[model samples]
Target: MPMHPIEVDDDVYALLQQHARPFVDQENDVLRRLLGLDGSPTAVANRVSGGDLRALIDAKLLAPGDELVHIQTRKGLTHRAVVTADGNIRLPDGSTYAKPSPALKACVGHDINGWGQWIHAQSRESLQSLREALRERQAD
Candidate 1:
């Protein structure tokens, strides 16, 4: 699971406290149930209902996982992701990130696909071979 660090303000904190009060069993539950979790390390998923969950998610105070990802829209968002064996990115938003063009600079607009643009090979032969291989494979 990926962890997105977020800052909470006093106002939001107070609101969460109020909403989570009845569900909370104690301090432990206050952190858990208020966050609408099963008390496991998996973290609160985006699939949860209610305004409070949305509030927390938009604030970045919480992150939704694989099972809960569809509950949210990640249209223009980008996250630090890793590449798999097939050259696909395991995106933080739980989406597959394809490679980007060379002009893909980190601009304020347009989410950059870092995996797509990052240099892949150091050796000249490897680079040429992979490039040709990918082109041929895609053409077929």
Candidate 2:
């Protein structure tokens, strides 16, 4: 891949810095679409519309997954599991979550890096069912 020098304005540069992951994600999506990997919004649109090659050149940005972890906090007093979307764990009680470091492991016998590693849950509803319910209500 050849690198091109395209100068962006200050605002765009700030946006790029602020939303770096999304920009990178959009690029990855474009490449994946070209390779026929499905599931992106643009890829779905391209498949349906036929003449729109926008998905080929387009970039779709989205938020990253949660930063999940199991944490032990405050003088070996309490332990509860939680997942963070942005690595933030500051509670109203003035405590913050930390990844299980060696010191934490020393305090507690067992150590775990993440809660989402062992903690999993799922949503029960689908788009079709939800849409059908909405349509029925609207008809009524």
Candidate 3:
């Protein structure tokens, strides 16, 4: 086995960090995954999809400790949570969800797109809108 050093911009580094688990995932593993190579014998990673709110933290659009609320459209119910320091969603019941979807499921007791469901408490911006804005920025 050989090792080499490479340089990437901060954003790319952030993406790599997001995928790399400390003491569990390595840089080579991250790179291999990015290149569509299977470096592990285990099943595929359980990665959260496009609506993942962690991206907001990475992009600095949202910060640790920021408040978010999910307003269930049909039930007219509201659930509140905060972003933990490590970028996980922390609900009032003291459970942490790695992504917004499951947290939302816990809230509404049903399946829903968390991005569209979760709104920033301060900005009132939906996670989907934030994602779209990020995409637009990248496209520009």
> In model 3, how large is the Cα lDDT of residue 33?
54
CA error at residue 41 for candidate 3, angstroms: 17
Whichever of 2 and 3 has more TM-score, that candidate is 3
lDDT of each: 0.35, 0.33, 0.71
TM-score for all models, in order of appearance: 0.21, 0.25, 0.58
Instruction: In angstroms, give how far residue 110 of model 3 lies from its true place.
Output: 0.9
lDDT of 3 by residue, 64-99 (tens): 889999876787878999876555676665445667
Q: What's the C-alpha lDDT at position 15 in model 2?
A: 45
Per-model C-alpha RMSD: 16.2, 15.4, 11.4
TM-score of 3: 0.58
Best by TM-score: 3
The candidate that wins on lDDT is: 3
- Model 3 residue 10 CA deviation (Å) reads 44
Q: How accurate is candidate 3 locally (lDDT)?
A: 0.71
